[model samples]
Target: MINRRDALRASGLATFGALALGAVDAGLTPAEATASGQLRGWTPLPDPAAGGVTSPPFPKNLTAEERRNLKTFDELDFTVFSSADWARLDESHAKHVRVHWPDGHYTDGIQKHIDDLAALFVWAPDTNIQVHPLRVAKGNLTAVTGVMRGTFSAPMPDGKGGYIEPTGRQYAINMATVGLWNRRGTMDEEFLFWDNQTFYSQIGL
Candidate 1:
């Protein structure tokens, strides 16, 4: 049986070579990406995790507060394409929110995560994240999946506390996120996952 990596390559979900990366770096920004744009066309083969199933089932007897919290989370997620106002995020996140990223980047508080994200927006001014159609909410946990599209327009942190100059490359990758809300209905913790190889390949790294 083909391995997961092989399967992703075979399905065209993952593209290879420096040329693929170089081509996108030649001025492809988020404004040029459409709902059916080429930059966002690479989709992985259907996986069980991404199946069209809503967790916690229908007729979700969620409380008004729960519903409101979920709604706020959705709004916050959309800020990647707009202004990621720190004060705004502060209002929606707990004072000590914990954030986890698949790449091992971790933030122990809301302010730190906001700072990190603010830097990302500066490097990729046109970054955009589009939420998936399915969202699952159960108890204090809420989950969402989405696509991230962005252009590296300025120098970016290399995850080693170092930095790399802009490559002008545009990238699109699938992302998943889960969050736990505090008693105040603000998100207190979150976990995010994405394909790092896909991202690196798109940026010609």
Candidate 2:
């Protein structure tokens, strides 16, 4: 299998080459990046666990409360959001669906989502997955907010967290690009779908 960094570099889109999540040195001139729009893309931020700044740009449009809400460490909850089929899970979608983190206390739907993806991994080992550095995208400010896609992979548990007991198993990477939003967060997963290897789309799932 191609290594994660190479695969991400190979992931073509608005994020190609250095624009795809990079390390922007502290105190570097913004002009160095402004000259290239690539500079505006998500830079490898300081790890939040170390208690540094969170989402520094704040997208310029979020309310103070919204911005403040962005500063917590909730990766497990956020990853579910990243991989969630939002139209089916997010009430915010055009067609609202119940949150796995449902309003009516603990629900089976929530547990099932975990069970389902875990089963999928066990059922299909050929599938390659990666979860990685999460980022957010700022749009028109008055409208939608965005989540950077993440990478998840094997030799690690894939969607296999949240089990209730000792048999709790992990089969995919614990690392994920699970970005939380002040509002609706997202997943910028660099995933590919294949149809017999001849016709397939390298999808950002």
Give per-model TM-scores. 0.65, 0.25
- Write model 1 residue lDDT over 49-156, tens digit each, in one string: 334422222224556765776677666777633566677886568889888777766789877888877876877887766455435555565655667778888888
Best-performing candidate as measured by lDDT: 1
Model 1 scores a C-alpha lDDT of: 0.62
lDDT of 1 at 78: 73
lDDT of 2 by residue, 1-205 (tens): 7344344334423232233233223221232456545655445555432333333343334445333433322333344344443233332211121222212222234344445445434433333322223323222111111222222222333346633222222222212221223244322122211121211111212
Worst 10 residues of 2 by lDDT: 196-205
- In angstroms, give how far residue 127 of model 2 lies from its true place: 16
